[model samples]
Target: MSNSNLNSSSNHFSCPKGGAGYVCPDEPQFVGCCSQDPCRNVDANSTSPCPGSNLYYASYDPFIHEEIPANACIDGGKWFTCTGANPSFIGCCASDPCKSPDHTGCPDDDLLPAAWSKSRPGQFALFQDEGTADDDELSGGAIAGIVVGAVAALVTIGALVWFFVRRRGNKAAAMSGHRHTSSVIEGEHRRMYPCPASPSFISSWIGAI
Candidate 1:
């Protein structure tokens, strides 16, 4: 190849199919010579890079009928595409978290895209609210309450039993005291009654003597 042709070839941007090129910050792939308009110069039918070769076209438009847009070629992170309408920003340029670095196809997020703003925030919020140790703490408190309640119930039962036993003992003592009082009354009556009647008769006889 001539030096001029070599220079021209060197100036041209060559990348593997579905491969990414040098990306300038805040610049879309369509802004430079690799834009959709420039790719039209190359034929879309051939796979080899020769003069009048459709390899450029084949590279530009892999599926013959549809032309791959310049913006689609730019690496817009892993899952997202940087379109002309919604160009990728610096913050959005990182590798996809869900896909491996070797992966070339669209990310799973893109194939089955989530409602990013709605689903992620809500999921994280729910995790924040319900994913703590509070449940375990609450269960511990409940167990403590049950244990205290059981102890209190046992103490109450013991006190009731003691009170009933003391009451029965007091009743038995009162019955014994009543029986002793009746016996003392019968003994006093036996000692005084006959003495009274005999003393009266004897006093009369002694006065006659």
Candidate 2:
């Protein structure tokens, strides 16, 4: 069917420049209201900007071969708890496909958009056959980073140890050189001032007698 026919059939309306303020965790394909229940609308006809949380892009789960609930955990489609005045309700993220002007995937077989948990947020789960490729890539990158950091730390420690050892060796060598110079000076003094215990002493004794 044409895009205009889909919009008219669904009774579609535009949300402001950015679209819905809150995401529909149950059916991320549709725009959601800020109330505890995504189905409840504060003012359906109002043209004012949606007053609620920030909008996020839709996260496609290739494993499921479908779009999982917005902001829901990929491991188990677990809904995150919403904070603020409505703490009892769950929060959602990701873009609403139904909000698109082109009426992309928003049209359903009934020619109606998502209405409050129609997508069944609880049903989404990762397929076991393929596993989570994205998560695995992230894990590999994290491991590489840790290894690089460890190597860098070891190199820095080695450099510091070598510097200290070289400085200590030079200091010891200088001290040894000073000691050797003092010893040589003492030996020269002994040679220049010979002891009076030879012919000089004997001549002096004979003269006195």
Candidate 3:
């Protein structure tokens, strides 16, 4: 029942001999192969036993050999453990939408574990960090989208700033040019008629504009 090798790279197991390898059966007594899973034989409550029961596997056990596809652990989002009515003979789950947490030892993607009843119930179980695994599931597309959005926002902001600055500079340059033109005209008029043009001439030229 030692779950020491649970969820590791290899699925090697160390099953005990005879009646000492089953968990939660009608009795602690179990003999022969580790076929009778304890997840189904656990303490039942209410009218139906396997309708919505959650499956939980022992991280470590002294007398059980946990099977990945066994109906002994509660890890799926929809069904914790398959009832006799909806027994998962072919597969444990169809598709995983409800992602598994970091400590659950599930894949980074939304897929559920291939099997159930992992890690027998006997040895000291090593639980994963209770942190969330959603970050691990971020796809390349999602990350790229975020990066593109950020860059586009920055470029837009820069363009707007440059437009305003260029517009302001143009206005200032125009104003200076107008002032210079006016000064040159006045100076030229004074030099052309040092005695000052006749009131009629002044009125005809400067007053015209």
Per-candidate TM-scores read: 0.30, 0.38, 0.33
Candidate 1 lDDT over 1-209, as tens digits, reads 10111012332222333222222212121212122222222245522112111111111111111111112233233223222111111112234422434434333232211111221222212112221123223334456899999999999999999999999999999999999999999999887765455787989999999
> In order, what is each prediction's RMSD in angstroms?
23.1, 14.1, 16.7
Q: What is the TM-score ranking, best to worst?
A: 2, 3, 1
Model 3 agreement with the true structure over 48-112: per-residue lDDT tens digits: 11222222221322112221223332334322222121111111333332233323422223222
Candidate 2 ranges beyond 4 A from true positions: 1-141, 198-209
TM-score, candidate number 2: 0.38
lDDT of each: 0.32, 0.36, 0.35
In model 2, the clashing pairs are: none
Would you give me the overall lDDT of model 1?
0.32
Largest lDDT belongs to which candidate?
2
Cα error, candidate 3, residue 46 (Å): 11
User: Residue 185 in model 3: shift from native, Å?
Assistant: 1.1
How displaced is residue 174 in candidate 3, in Å?
A: 0.8
